[model samples]
Target: MNGLLRFSRGVDWVNAQVGKYIIWLILASTVVSGVNAVVRKLFNMSSNAFLEVQWYLFAAAFLVAAGYTLLHQEHVKIDVLSSRLSKRGQIWVDIIGFTFFLTPICLAILWYGIPFFLQGWRSGEMSNNAGGLVRWPVYAMIPLGFTLLMLQGWSELIKRIAFLQGRIEDPTAKRAEKSAEEELAESIRRLAEAEADAGKKAD
Candidate 1:
């Protein structure tokens, strides 16, 4: 049990690091989109490569963040139903869902995704669009993302079981930590309030 807990923690750490780094991909994609739009509007010049690269980055960010989403319990849930259930009931629901639903889905994706990626790589697949990027790099994200997701599912399953066994606290408890976007929004709100207060004082 102790060893399983440690393994779960290690999987959590890997997903955490991957999630943190993947945020930069979103930023990069945004920057590329902005630049591409500007160039297209101002110069009336555009390339499929730029457009495709943006899609690739967006896909990479979305796919790679699956495990991170699972780790934070940010994945979609029917809280209206589940919230009405007892803690143990909810844990049981999660255990059943992860075991029966999530695991099989991820495994199926990996089974197909690996071959898809391999075919792209072997064929040196490129986009059909003019001046577009190669396809394998983006294709590879499918398997990689699912692998991470599957690992995190296992980690979550282990934690839920441990909780049920009285070896740990509630596995589904929400952490109070704010995300980066939340913190930034909070700072902006505080600055606005301060400015309003200063204006009132001047009046």
Candidate 2:
């Protein structure tokens, strides 16, 4: 169990790092989209490659961040029923869900996705659209993303089991950390207050 806990922490750290870095992909995609739009509208010139690259980046960011999303517990959930359960019950529900539902789904995706990616790579698949990018890189994200998600699922299972065994604190407890938006809002509030204080001193 101790070894498993250490492995879980490692998985969590990997996902956390991946999630943090993947945010830059979003910015890159946004920039590409803006540039593509401008080039299309202003110069009346565009290529499928530009459009497809943007899509690839978007897909990469979305898919690669799955494990990270899970680590943060930010995934959507239907809490209508489960919200009523005790913490232990909720953890049990998660264990069952991860074991029965999430793990199988990820495995199935990987089973199909690997072949899909390999076929594209082996055949040197290109987009049907004019001047489009190669297909394998985008295809590859499916299996890669699912693998990360599956690993995180195992990490979560370990954490939950450890918690149940009195080896750790609540596995589901949210960290009391503010989001970037929240921190920015706080900074703005402080600036406004400081400005108001200066005005008061002047008066």
Candidate 3:
């Protein structure tokens, strides 16, 4: 149990670090997109490589962030019914979902995704679009991302079980501070409310 807990902590740390660093990928993508647009308009020049790199960066960030999202418990959840359940009951629900659903789904994707990535890498597949980058890097993300996510799932499973065994604090307790997703959702909700108010004033 202690060993498992240590492993879980390691996974959590890795995902947290990954989540922090991947924000740069998004920023880089945005910069590349802005530069591409400006160059297109100003110099009447552009390349598919520039456009494709932006997509690569975005996809890398989105895919690699899966484990990070899970670590923070930021994945979408329909808590309406679960909220009414006992803490242990909620943990069991998660255990069942992680074992029966999340595990199998990730395994299936990895089974297929590994081969997909390998074929692309072996073939040195290039994008059909001229001046575009090779496809293997993006293909690799499918398997790599899911592997990270699966590791996090196992880490979460370990924590939940530890909590049930009285070996650790409740894994499902509300974090002290807001997660990035929660903050983003709140910001979006506030923006929507502000827009609605402006519309009402105009009317």
For lDDT, the strongest prediction is: 1
Q: Which candidate is the best by TM-score?
A: 1
lDDT of 2 by residue, 1-203 (tens): 99999999999999987876777677788899999999999999998998999989999989998998898899998799889998888999999999999999999999899999999999999999989999999999999899999999999999999999999998789999765346546766988999999999999
lDDT-wise, the better of 1 and 2 is 1
lDDT of 3 at 105: 99
Where does model 3 exceed 4 Å of error? 177-203
Worst 10 residues of 1 by lDDT: 179-188
Task: List where candidate 1 sits over 4 angstroms from the true fold.
Answer: 180-203
Error of 3 at 181 (Å): 9.3
Candidates 1 and 3, the one with greater TM-score: 1
Q: Model 2 misses residue 106 by how many Å? A: 0.7
Clash pairs, candidate 2, are none
**TM-score of every prediction relative to native:** 0.89, 0.87, 0.86
Per-residue lDDT tens digits for candidate 1, residues 3-100, read 99999999999998898778778778989999999999999999999999998999998999899999999999999999999999999999999999
